[model samples]
Target: MKDAEKLAAFCATIADERKADNIVQLKLADISTVTDFFILCTANSEPHLRAIADTIVRDAREKLKVRPRKVDGKPASHWIIIDYTNVLIHIMTNEMRELYQLESLWGDAPTVSAIKTLRKKTPA
Candidate 1:
C-alpha cells in the first residue's frame, strides 16, 4: 500500500485500541527537508502510550510492510516519536504537548484532520 494509505490504517488501528485521544494528520509533502506527514496525538497514560506505539508498529509492519527507522522518548513515556522515512508520529502528554508546541512550530503544515481537537481540551 502507499504511504498515505498505510498511514490512515495505522491511525485508525491506534484509535481502535483507544490509545489516542485524537489523531491529526498533516501533509508535509512539500517540505523536502522534513517528513511527508506529521501524526500528532495524545495518550492517556504510560500503558496507553505503549499500546499506541505498539499498535503503530504492528500496523505499519503488517499492513504497510514498513517500520519506523528510529524511535525516541520511549523511556519517559512522556513523549514518544516514531519516525518513518516519510512520516513522524508524536504521542505526548497534555503539558508536554503544549510545552513543545509542535503544531505551532510546524505551523505551515496543512492539517488533514481535527479528530481529537473537536472537543475541549481534557486533562489527563
Candidate 2:
C-alpha cells in the first residue's frame, strides 16, 4: 500500500480500538528519508499506552500485511515506539507528550490528526 494509505489505516485502527486521542500521522519523507510516516497518539495510563501500541502493531500486521522491526519502551507507559520500515508509531502519556513534543522536533513533516473522537470504546 502507499504511504498515505498505510498511515490512514494505521491511525483509523488505533482510533477504532479507542486507544488514542488527538492522533497525528506525520509524513517524515524528507527528514533522512527513513520512514514514510510517524504516527503519534496519547493515552491516559501505562496500560492504555500499551493497548495503543499493541493495537497498532496487530492491525498493521494483520490488515496492512506489515510488521514492525522492533518495539521499545513498554516497561512504563511514558512512551512506546513501534518501528515499521516505512512508518513508526509513537504512543505516549499526556505528560511525556508535552515534554518531548515530537511535532516541534520534526517541524517539516505533515502531521495528520484523528478526525473523530475516540472516547468510550474500552479496550478489549
The TM-score leader among the candidates is 1
> How well is each residue in 1-124 modelled by candidate 2, as lDDT tens digits?
3865555555556655674775777777766477777777778888888777777778777877777789989737489988776777788888988999987888887765544445786699
User: For model 1, where is the 10-residue window of minimal lDDT?
Assistant: 1-10
How far off is residue 22 in model 1, in Å?
3.1
User: What is the C-alpha lDDT profile of model 1 across 1-124, one tens digit per residue?
Assistant: 2666467546655654664776777777775477777888887677878778887878778877877789888726589888886778888877777788888877887887757543456799
lDDT for each candidate structure: 0.73, 0.73
Angstrom error of the Cα, residue 99, model 2: value is 0.5
Q: Scored by Cα lDDT, where does model 1 land?
A: 0.73
- Give the TM-scores of the predictions, in the order they appear: 0.80, 0.80
TM-score between candidate 1 and the true structure: 0.80
After superposition, which runs of candidate 2 have C-alpha atoms over 4 Å from their true positions? Answer: 1-4, 75-77, 113-124
- Model 1 residue runs over 4 Å out of place are 75-77, 117-124
